[model samples]
Target chain A: MEWDWAFVMQILPTLFEGVKITILATLLGSIVAAALGLVIAILRRSKYRLISMPTGFIAEFIRGTPLLVQLYFIFYVLPDMGITLAPLVAGVIGLGLHYGTYAAEVYRAGIENVARGQWEAAKACNLTAFQTWTRVILPQALPPMIPALANYFIAMFKETPLLSAITVLELMNQARSIANFNYRYIEPITLVGAFFLAISLISVIGLRWLERRYGRIG
Target chain B: MININRLGGAVSAAVLSSLLFAIPAKAEDTLEKLKEQGFARIAIANEPPFTAVNPDGTVSGAGPDVARAVFKKLGVNDVVASISEYGAMIPGLQAGRHDAVTAGLFMKPERCNAVAYSEPILCDAEAFLVKKGNPQGFKSYADIAKDSSATIGAPGGGTEERLSLEAGVPRDRVIVVPDGQSGLKMLQDGRIDVYSLPVLSINDLVKKANDPNIEVVAPVVGAPVYCDGAAFRKNDTALRDAFDKELAAMKQSGEFAKIIEPYGFSAEAAMSTTREKLCSASN
Candidate 1:
């Protein structure tokens, strides 16, 4: 009933403590996603059906199911199979694995967007496959990915709530617990939204700066 | 040598009687309406000691345990537990998301304005969960307030958060986790100094975690017990009354306590009166 500015002030500092966990999960999750995306992108381009076909299916399968279900599977079911991970570890892995499938498509699009003439030029220079990709194609292809990758970082920040399902007490979970105890969802939940908005606004501005920087590189 | 046909007819009749008596519905007018629809949808949060989603994806818990028995007695053959959050359970009922909530939703005055509750299925006191030795020596939220480093995990819209806040534990010190599992994990990992939750719910967490390091600090600060029960939309007064009648019968017969006690609850606890006089403001 009463909007206690002092109470909000008191709560804000504690939630700030959780920001480290939030940033850590998103940072670690994004790195895993980037690596996994690269692998899937390469697999999709492989000449062998054995490699490409199942890689595509696995990507589709991970994409098809809800991230929450995947999280539950990793946290609840995997332990029975003798695979165990801490809550945050399992959360980052599941979040990364799920989003990586989508990122693989982004990477695929970026790689494909590299002008066909560039590949021919690399060959004309007598460049090997690694040299051709590293020196010629990837340098051109990767810049466009910066915006999309930055976007994934933002998306991952929003998706941190899913980590709560796997028992990772990020910002939203903290808000929910506060709301539950106080019987006032309005304050704590509003604070969660405000916190999200604040972070997201900063991220969007930072990402725009990245996009512009990478746009010139393009 | 015997009349086999007669024996068969007599045996079938006895089985039918047993089944008929299992769930004694009001047979009041609405009973036919519910039966015509074919299923009684019960909302649940799927948390243990209250409602849980079984490994097979079926639902069970003290709340459902009592509800299921009452439904069986009411002749509601198909009782389904629909997943719903504790905060949303009342709204879900009001919006017709389900016929009723079988979760451990407390019957507070605020909730009473929106929904009617059946007799309390389980009465639980709020309590603090601490490390095995209780290294911080937490007797209540005062202990938490004394320590600047102390943090508590209280799920959203749960009573623990309220108690902690009321005790002057800063809003920041209380981590509003989404569920008991995370709260317990946070406590285990030392990310939280204490986890304040329903004694029963925390007990369920301790059992589920099966960790030796965590234990319940008896009778949480400020209150002895809170009454939690099945809630129905205020408009469903008839259904609420029917449920109450059957639940009262169950309690009187001692069947309610028998069914729920195994889930780390006391049948006597449920039977205890929830008179306001009994609920004290200070510990």
Candidate 2:
């Protein structure tokens, strides 16, 4: 079909609003994922099986299930149990919980990569458990994981479109709605692709810079 | 690997662009086409009483039934139907993906400009599915718009969505429910405050849902009645004319009422209206 620049101009404002929601969800979801992943990783390293085993299983369960199904359960199924959340909130939780599991694995690798002597050094320094973790282990374990964590966050951003399934007014949903209204899928869909490509390329550059900055870490 | 991905992307883009821009088939002896093929390809939506896809994969509902009979009279043996969304129906027909849209795709001025429509066939009024006792008392689209916190669930690109938007409900508040079942589910889950569809469609959904907690508010306040005809591509006037002639004859023979009445459509409502009048009527 012919490219309709006028139509593109008309749809830009609505699409930008959708873009804002998409970015907001990705940012919020990333924060939730990063924090929750660290918690799971630390808990899984505990000496008690009661803590470690269940933590591992729960992370695996979250990891194994599809995010779309999880979104449906959160948006459609949760209300039956009296746990209703707004569409965006339900979408954010689904994204965060699912990606948090993968983030947990990245944390595990980074923590494991730290030298065995680091723990011994912390003990010899007479540091308490909290100080040992906060001051010694994490500082060393964290930098190398930045690139990997950034990668997952970028991956999570791409997946933000899945939020539309739960009725979140995100970018993809906006494009579809516009397409349906105007009977023109080409323009709106092309605009969506362009927006996604621009964001993904910028983030890839950021990821490359991160890899360089943290390249020498253990 | 990056080079391969780039190449693959380019190839797929070419394929998609070709499909999107492909010329619509010329309507040379369009009626003869159906006679030779033994069936006409019609687009339908899966909203029962208007259009439905049976569990056995056969297509039924008032719109298709009327189209089937009309086509048969024109020496077309049967109609092959595919389900589509209301928004995509016209574009799909223009793209040559469907020969005619027999679904309850209502006639409006903008739509009439895009496609050639036969006389009106299935007519309906707007209805809302709400909590029992009409908790919010949403009698019209304006009422939903007035309640700042209320949201409506309607089929994407359907008349209900357009009407709600025209009535001043903001875009975010009008949730695009995919199908009848999902709309019902969303209403039950309190995801949307009101689920809007045509009167017969709401009735059909309510009957199947059999839920005591839900109720129907028909003849939505301030929404006008609408009618849908068999819509063909703009250049397919000869085919449209043939279909219209048979449709009018069917109406005269009392056959049109038989096909649509069982599905809860009022044939008189359709018979009393003309495509020109419905298409030109102000919304």
Candidate 3:
């Protein structure tokens, strides 16, 4: 019940190590999610049903399952199929895959928001399909998507705690270990909450700045 | 949107501030509360031989059996059981989630500081589950530490994890496997080099796993034999003392042995040590 400042100081380094892992996992997972989401959005919008239908089904399946169960399946169950991933790699992949499905919807909405006239204008400019997507469509579409992507990045940060179940030793896992070793819960748990709040608040401020800087479609 | 966000923050702040004054006022007598309720809620890890949940949905095993008998004598007619992890059991007791923990949670100095423990109810030695033929020839946690590639699996926050770390095994090499079952599976899958648990627990798991590739190494080197007591919150010292008295009487009457002996625990080992002796011993 008593908060021990000395104990807190002693454990801060260990917790900070965990914070580094948490941030690493979130950053890597966010990158994977963003790229994978674009792939999923592109495939789901394919002209052929043969490609788009299966892509849509796979995205929905990943979205439907719990992230924790998927992490377990990837970390523990995948070895049976002769695929073994290191814990951090497994955790990052799990988080990225799970959030990528949701991010795909955001990408789809961003792409759809581009006017039909923009596509026609690119065609009239004698641009190739790739040039049209890269120069005209995506440049306009990406700005509005920044805030939504930032929101998912923050969401992925919160979900990083679940990576502990697979033994990734992230921030919450570090706090639990400290609590278990010291038999003091209040301080470490409260510190974890504070850490999460501070990071989220910072991310929100950054998101607002991005929105103000790039939100205008024109 | 800003107003809603402000309101949500304000409400959460108010709630968090209110929790500062909301500590559950402990009743003067915990035993009296248990007696009035007619059932004592005890936490148990579903590790076989120490604590197990039967196929019939009943709780059994040496720990619960000893605890149930002691509580029954104290006029608590029933002992309801909640299956929890070894690390969470103590916090569960402190959080008022359980009346007692009889999950063979060993009485180490750090744990002794957390909860009031009754006299010893079960005594066990450390053991490791390794691949058959003991390919790595790992005899102790030190052996695992010496081998750079070896990964040892132990329950998170349990005594075995502490032992491995104390023996110089790096934190990364000591994989915190979730439970007994998962530890065995991890061993089978070659996910970890060794799975550490109590001797009886390893025996039980290896038997159930029925895998010829698995072998048990008992009395792990540099690890001491430890005993566990039914742990109660520090405020429940009166109830714990009463429970200890009843446990001593049961030991003397041969009733304690009759209950725990069937589960592969030595009643003599449990009776030999006092809680004070075990609690003061730093692991």
Best by TM-score: 3
Best candidate, DockQ:
2
lDDT of 2: 0.91
- lDDT per residue for candidate 1 within B35-148, as digits (tens), equals 676668888875687778888988888888788788777778777888865655654565556777877776666566656677777777777889998888888777787788
> What interface Cα RMSD is found for model 3?
1.5
RMSD in Å for model 2: 4.1
| lDDT of candidate 2 over B153-221, digit per residue (tens) | 999889999999999999999999889988998899888999999999999999999999999999998
Interface RMSD of 2: 1.4
- Tell me how many clashing residue pairs each candidate has: 18, 0, 0
CA lDDT of each candidate? 0.76, 0.91, 0.90
Candidate 1 Cα errors over 4 Å, as ranges: A1-66, A69-109, A112-139, A143-160, A166-218, B1-32, B52-59, B71-78, B170-173, B176-186, B204-210, B261-264, B275-283
lDDT of 3 by residue, B75-123 (tens): 9999999988677888889988899999989999888988999999999
* Candidates ranked, most accurate by TM-score first: 3, 2, 1
Q: lDDT of model 2 at residue B238?
A: 96
**DockQ-based class of model 1:** incorrect
Task: Report the candidate with higher DockQ, 2 versus 3.
Answer: 2
Which parts of model 2 are misplaced by more than 4 Å? A43-61, A117-131, A216-218, B1-27, B30-39, B75-78
